[model samples]
Target: MFKNIYFVCFILILSSCGKDPLPKPSGELRLEYPAHKYQSFNSDCAYSFDYSTFAEMQNAKQSCWFYINYPKMKAKIFLTYFPIHNDFALHVKEAEKLVYEHTIKASSIDTKSFSYPEKKVYGNFYELQGPTASNVQFYVTDSTKHFVTANLYFNSRPKPDSLAPAVEYIKKDMLHLIDTFKWK
Candidate 1:
């Protein structure tokens, strides 16, 4: 009886080890964002631009500051408008400083400048990579009278991989905003 029991146990163990366990097929979460369609954002403030129809704009304390909320993605792009007021250098410096502040955790920061001399719109667009708090920052100015800065933030934990799709979608929206931007 003991020999029969041992033989049965051995067979069971051998059967369980038959094939090599395959590693879980390495995979990543696939996320899809909405296709962007934009509309004009006209305000009583110093500047105006085109924003994604997907986002909802909310008023802030000051007339010149507003939030472009992406409720679905749990993110918002904060826009602040400042009058140049013979202090253009100070405004530009502050914008650069704000971008550099994320350097501690940023893997890389890429800046691209856009100029529309015909429309008198000029500024710098910054894309900050890594686990930084703000993934994108930009400042557009008419150089003498208007300086508008925008930055993006997510409501949840800053996971670069998880937020990549949302960031890319918003980035395109922002670029379109810059291209159509004009002083009001």
Candidate 2:
């Protein structure tokens, strides 16, 4: 009986040696983005803009159409070019339609108009919030000869909370591109 009692006490002491079970503390992931560096993208197309060195440029099937692919982020900026042969309004409408299509999943969309009279660049920048498949879209044109539309897409499902850092980093780069855009 004494031996069994000592065994029980030993087991009890051994069990008590472990610390109390505790839930893990909640934490957010920390994402780091590299410093921004840009290079001039020159093509035989109607326009030229500065693109990030971090992104790889791929030739699209159509002339003047290209993709700025970020392999590390698994994101891409698609650029489509159309020559405006008295179809400026149509091109603008088409670009707007594409952005509006995301309204079903987007919580909100904010539009910013860009105008550079000297450069002849005019367009709207759309920033979509929530779980929309695309977070940003924009269209720029000289309103006479060249119309270009751009969209940013990620390969993975968009969880804004997780993608916030990458999104913000890319956002600045995109804005830089838009600001420096020149019609050739």
Candidate 3:
């Protein structure tokens, strides 16, 4: 009985050596981005703007369309060009449609209108908050002949909390593009 009692005591001592279980404190993810460097994007298209050197500009399937690809962030900004033929309102409607399509999944949506009458650039920027397929979208035009629409999409599932940094980074770049936009 003494031997059995000693055996139980040893087992108890060994098991008690471990620290008490504790729950880990939750933490937010930290993401880092490089300094922003931009260069003017020139093409046969009628409009021009500056884009980040961190991204690659590729020609899209359609004429005058382009994709600014951020391989590091696994995201892409798709830009589509349309020569307005008395359809400026139609193009604006289409851009609003694309942004509103995510309403079902988006927690909230904000719209900002911008115009550079000197450059003849006018547009609305839409920022959607949530796990939607797109977080930022916009449309720009000269209100006479040229129209362009853009959407920012990520390759992976969007957890707004996790993607907030990347979204803000790209959103700033997009805003820069809009600010420098000019219709030629």
Candidate 4:
């Protein structure tokens, strides 16, 4: 009787010592991103933009913009180009029109303007605004030659706050491409 009681006690004790599994560290999770790939179309058009290999590029059937996909990240980047006459004010207005039409509006808009003295990636000069109230937009022109603009959107599942970092990283890449941008 004592032996059976001891066995039951031992079993109970062992069962009572149960432990929960350790929680995973969020930082240890790995994510896969696509390799960088680029394609160049003829420069006979007003402008050209190069996209990362990870992005799938397609023209919007309804608009004049190229839709770039970052499928792994469930995000998108936008590119649009237009020819400008001699009017700087008119070009700025056109840029505003593009932004208003496409970008999502947050509670507040933050706008910063930049002027590059020399060509960086795309042409002789460029202007852009970052962390805007709506979407992202940048315009490039070589005082006398061409005008081009790019807008970025995070479409798949947009979490503006979560996407800000990735968006900024891609923006730098875009800037590099723009800085070295040349029209052939």
**Residue runs of model 4 more than 4 Å from their true location after superposition:** 1-43, 61-65, 96-135, 156-158
Clash totals, every prediction = 0, 0, 0, 11
Best by lDDT: 3
Q: What pairs collide in candidate 3?
A: none
TM-score ranking from best candidate downward: 1, 3, 2, 4
The whole-model lDDT of each prediction reads: 0.92, 0.93, 0.94, 0.57
Alpha carbon lDDT at 96, candidate 1: 98
lDDT of 2 by residue, 61-167 (tens): 99999999999999999999999898888999999999999999999999999999989999999999999899999999989899999999999998988888888
Candidate 4 has its poorest 10 consecutive residues by lDDT at 120-129
Q: How close is candidate 3 to the true structure, as a TM-score?
A: 0.86
Q: Per-residue lDDT tens digits of candidate 1, residues 1-184?
A: 9999999999999888867788997676686877889999887787888999999999988878999999988999999988877899999999999999999999999999888999999899999999999999999998989888999999988889889989999999989999888887
Candidate No. with top TM-score? 1
lDDT of 3: 0.94
* Candidate 4 C-alpha lDDT tens digits along 1-184: 9999999999999998868879976552334344445665434465555656666777766344567666766666656665556775677677667655533444444454555555433222222233343345666766555666666665535445555656666666566556556654
Residue 150's lDDT in candidate 4: 67
**What's every prediction's RMSD, in angstroms?**
3.8, 4.1, 3.9, 6.4
Listed in order, each prediction's TM-score against the native is 0.87, 0.86, 0.86, 0.56
